[model samples]
Target chain A: MTAAALEAARVWLVVALTLLGLFFSFVSMVGVLRLPDLYSRAHTASQADTLGAGFGLAAVALTVGLAGAGFKSVLLLFFIFVTNPTAAHAIARAAFEEGIVPWTNGDERR
Target chain B: MADADPPPGDGASADGPVDSAETSGPSAEASDADATSGPTTSGPTTSGPTTSGPTATAGAIIVPVEPTSTLRSTIAHVAEAAANDGAPALHLVEIASWRDGDPESDERAAAAERVLERVAAWATADLDDSEAPAAADVEVVTAVIGADDYLFGADDYVRVLAEYAEENAADRVVLDPEYTPVGNTTLLQPLEFALSNTSLSVETAPVDRPTRRERFRTEATTGRFVALFGLSLAFYLLLGDPTYWFDAVTGVATAAVVSITLSRVSLDSTPAIPRTPMRIARGLVYVPVLLYEILKANLVVARVILDPRLPIEPTLNRMRVIVGSGLPLMTLANSITLTPGTLTVRARDSDLYVHSLVPWAREGLFDGSLERWTRFVYYGRRSARLPTPRERDDVAILQGDDATEELPIAAADGGAVGAGDESDGGDETDAAESIDDEVTDR
Candidate 1:
C-alpha cells in the first residue's frame, strides 16, 4: 500500500475504535442511571466503562505503533483489565456479606 | 416511601433508599451507595448457619460417591475423621461423568442413581438405623448431593474433587484413597496432591508448586530476568536511538537483576504465569467477544435508559459453579462483572450470585453462553462444542416444562434418585404435575 493509504487506514482504525469506545462509555452512564439496583448499575460502570477505556487506549496504541506512547497505552490497558473487575467483585461481595437482599420481581419499594 | 409505589424515575437521585434522603444534599450514605459502590443492599435472609455459636465440626465434609469398595472404606474413615474433627455432616456427591456427545436420555441420571444406591446400601449395612447412637464412631449424617451436570458438564467440568467439595461450602474434604474403577483401573489420588495449586489472581494460598524464591535463584528465574531486561531494553529503544547499545543493554540488565532480587526477597510474590501460546490465543478470543458484547450491551442499555417510561426490572440470579479451581471461578465472576448487564455479587465456593439489570438480561443467566465460554477456558476447545441432543433439550426446559419433557428420573431407583439434586426435585415435581395436568385434560 502507498504511504498515504497506510496512514489513512491507521487513522480510520483509530477513529473507529475510539468512536466505539466513546459510545460505550457514554452508554455506561445510562446503565448506571437507569438500572435500579446496586449490582445492576455496577455492570455498566465496571464492564462497559472498562471496555470503553480499553478500546480508547487500544486506539492510541494502534495509532502510535511501537513507540513509547503506544507501549504505555498497552500497559494502562493491562492495569485497567486487572483492577476494574477486581474492584467491582470486592464491592459486590461486601454488599452481599452485609446482608443485602437482591431485588426480584414485585419487590417492595423504598 | 411506600413499597407498592413504582420506582421514582423522575431523575432526582434514583440511587435508592440510601440515596432517597440525599435530596437535602449528598450525604455520606449517598457517596457510599453511588454507582461505583455496586450492588444494592436490601433484603436480609436467614442468618448464616455458622453465626449462632462456635462449633468445631459445625461444617460439612463432601465425599464424591464412587461405586467401589474404596467409597465404603472412605465413608468409614471419613466418618471417623469427622468424629475426630467434630463435623457431623457428610455430603455424598455422585459426579455422573458424561462426555458432550451423550444422548440427553436418562443414562447420566441412571449412572448417578447407581452410585447413590451403592452408598445407601453401604450405609444401611454399616450404620445403625435407630435414632440412638449407632457405633462407637461419631454420628455422621449423610446428605446426598447432586449436580445438574451432564446436561451442563461442558460448563461445569471440575478437574479436582477438592474444588467440587469447596463449591458445596464443605470445607472439610475427604476423598477415597484411590479410584480403582472396573476392568480398566483409573487410580484417583487423595486430596493431598490435588489441593496444591491455588488462586493466581491473589495470594489466596500456596499452590503445591515449588516456591519461586527457592527455584528463582537458580534455573527458572533466569527466563523472567531475561524477559524483564528485554522489556526495559525495548522501552529504551522505543524512546529513541541510543548512543551505545551495549550501555543500554548493561544498564537494563542491572535494573532487571535488582528487580528480580527484590521480588525474590518480597514476602508476597505473584503467581508464575502458566503461559502457553494456545491459552493466550483462547484468552484473546474472549477479548473480542467481550468488546463486541460491550457494543451490543451499550446499545441495549442505552435504549433501556432512554425509554420514555423508564421500564426497568432488577433481579438476582444464582447458579452452582461446575467449573474447576479458583482461577476459572474467578474468571467467570470477573467476566460477569465486566459484562454490561449483569454484575456478579458473590462467588462463594462454587455458587455464583449475580444481579441483572433487566428481566430479559437474566434469561440465560444460569445455563448460557457465558457458561460455555467459562468451561472452554477451564478445560479446552472441545468444552465449547455445540450441545448434542441432551444439552439442547435443557434449553427447552429453561423455557417451560413440557408435559412429555423428560422421563430420565423414572429410571432411577427412589433410593438413588435425588443423590446430590436437592434443588432438582422441585423442578422434576413440577414436570410431573404438568404431565398430570396433560393426562387429566386429555
Candidate 2:
C-alpha cells in the first residue's frame, strides 16, 4: 500500500507478465512448428500467439498507466483478440469449402 | 462435458456438435468389437448419416442487437464477418428484456418486434452480397429473445439470447455493446456479461467513436496534443538559447499546427478505442489472464512437441456452445487451438468442431473449466461447464487394421469379401496394404 512497496509490486508484476507472455509465444512457436495439420497449427498461432502478445502489451500498459504509449498497447491487444482467430477461421472455412478433407486417424474418408 | 454425447456421432467418435439423429450405430459393425472399439466410425455404413446430416450452422449466421449509434457498423461488419464459405443465411436477433408477468411488457415486446423487422430489412439492404450465405436464398430471419422462455427469471436475458442462437443454429453472434439500457449501466451489465459468457463467438460491433483529435477537447484526447505542445516549448527553453522566448513562440505555433492536422482525420478505423478509464482498466486485467492461459497452453504444446515418442491420439470434440456471442466463442476457439495438441477444424451453430491431438487433450476440451473462465472474465458470471462425456471404448487403429501390411493375406480375404469384382478387390487390398505399410514404417 505504501509508495515504495506499490512501485516494487508493479515492477515485479510487469516482469512476470512479460516473462509469461514470452513463454507463451515460445510455446505457440512450438505449436505452429510441431502440430500435425493446418488446423492444429492455426490453434497454436491464433490462440497462443494472441495470448503472448496480449501479455506483453498488458505489461506495457501497467508500466505506463494511461500515457499515450499505454493506450496504444491496449488498442493493439484488442485488435489481436478480434482478428487473429477470425482470420484463422476464414482460412479453415475456405479450406473446408474447397474440399480439403480434414486429416483423421485410419480410414476416415472411406 | 459432451452434452448429448450420442451413442456414436461421426466417423470420428469425437466430432462436432452431436445431433442425436446423426449417431451412426450399425455402421461400425465390421465386428461388434470394431463397432465398440471404433466408437466414432460415423458410418451406418461407409457413408454415414452423420456426414450427410445438416450441420448446425450450415444454414444461418445470427446477430443479436439493440438500438444504438453503432447499429450501422454492426450490420456492415456482421454481413462481411459471418460471410464464411457457403454463405449462410442471416438471422437478426433482438432480445426483449421485459419481465413477462406485466401486460405492458407484452406491448413493449410487440413494439420491439416491429422495430426488429425494420432493423433486419435495413441490414439486409446494406448487404452487398446477399449470396454471402448462398445464392438465391438470401433471407433475413429475425427473432425476439424473451425472458419467459427460460424457467428462470428475466435476469436470464443473456441465457435466452444464447438459447435462441443455438435453437436457430446460427453460426455467429454479432452485436453492438453500446446498449446501456436508457443509460442505466446495471441493466446493460447482465447483457454484456451474458454475451461474453455464451460459448458461441460474440463479436462486439465496432463503433467509430472519434479519437482525441476528433473529439475536440475530451480528457482522453487532450493529454496527447498538450504533451506535444508542452514538449516542444520545453525543448526550446532547455537549449539555453538567449532568444528563448522567440524560440518558444515558434515551437508553440509549430506544435499547434501539427496537432490540428493530426487530430482532423482521427483514428476512427483503428479497432474500437477504449475511451473510458474503466474500459482501459478492465482490458488491462483481461489481457494478463489471456496471457496466463497462453503461457499454460504453450507449456502444454511444448511438452507434446518435445516428447520423444510423439504421443498424439487425434480425436474430434463436438462442443455444444454455451455462449452465443462471437467474441467469447472465438476467444474460446482460439484458446483451444492455441493449447498444445488441439485444433478447431470447423465452427457451426451450437457446436465447435475441434480436432485434439491426444485423448488427454480431447478430455481437456470436454472439461468445461476453460469455458467457465471465459464467461467469468468476459461477462462476470460462471455457468455450469461442459457436460460429462459418455463412457466410450478408446478408439485407435486396431492391429487388424495394421495387419493389412500382410498384402497377400488381405488380398485373398478381399477377394472372398467382394466376390464379383476380383480386380477391384485386388486393387483395394493393395491400397490398404500400402497405407498400412507406410503408417507402420513411419
Query: What DockQ score does model 2 reach against the true complex?
Result: 0.16
Docking class of 1: acceptable
lDDT of 1 by residue, B8-91 (tens): 322224344532121224232332321222221111111113232324534556565555434545554554344335443445
Worst 10 residues of 2 chain B by lDDT: B390-399
Candidate 2 lDDT tens digits, B1-442: 1122222211223243323332234323322321132222211112122223322244456666665555655665655444333334667766654435432456657756655655554444333222222222334566666645312222355566667767766545665655533222324555555567567665566656331122213543465555455555564454435265786677677668766665423322112233234334644666666557655655565666567665554544455545433455666777665554556655543346566655556555655556655544443422323243221111112122222112121322223322112122224334334544443312
- Give the per-residue lDDT of model 1 (tens digit) for A1-110: 69999999999999999997887777777767655666666777874557689789889899888566788888787678777888987887676666555554456542
* Residue B43 of model 2, lDDT score: 15
Best by DockQ: 1
Off by over 4 Å in 1: A1-19, A105-110, B1-275, B385-421, B428-442
Q: What is the C-alpha lDDT of each candidate?
A: 0.50, 0.51
lDDT of 1 at B160: 41
TM-score of chain B of each: 0.39, 0.32
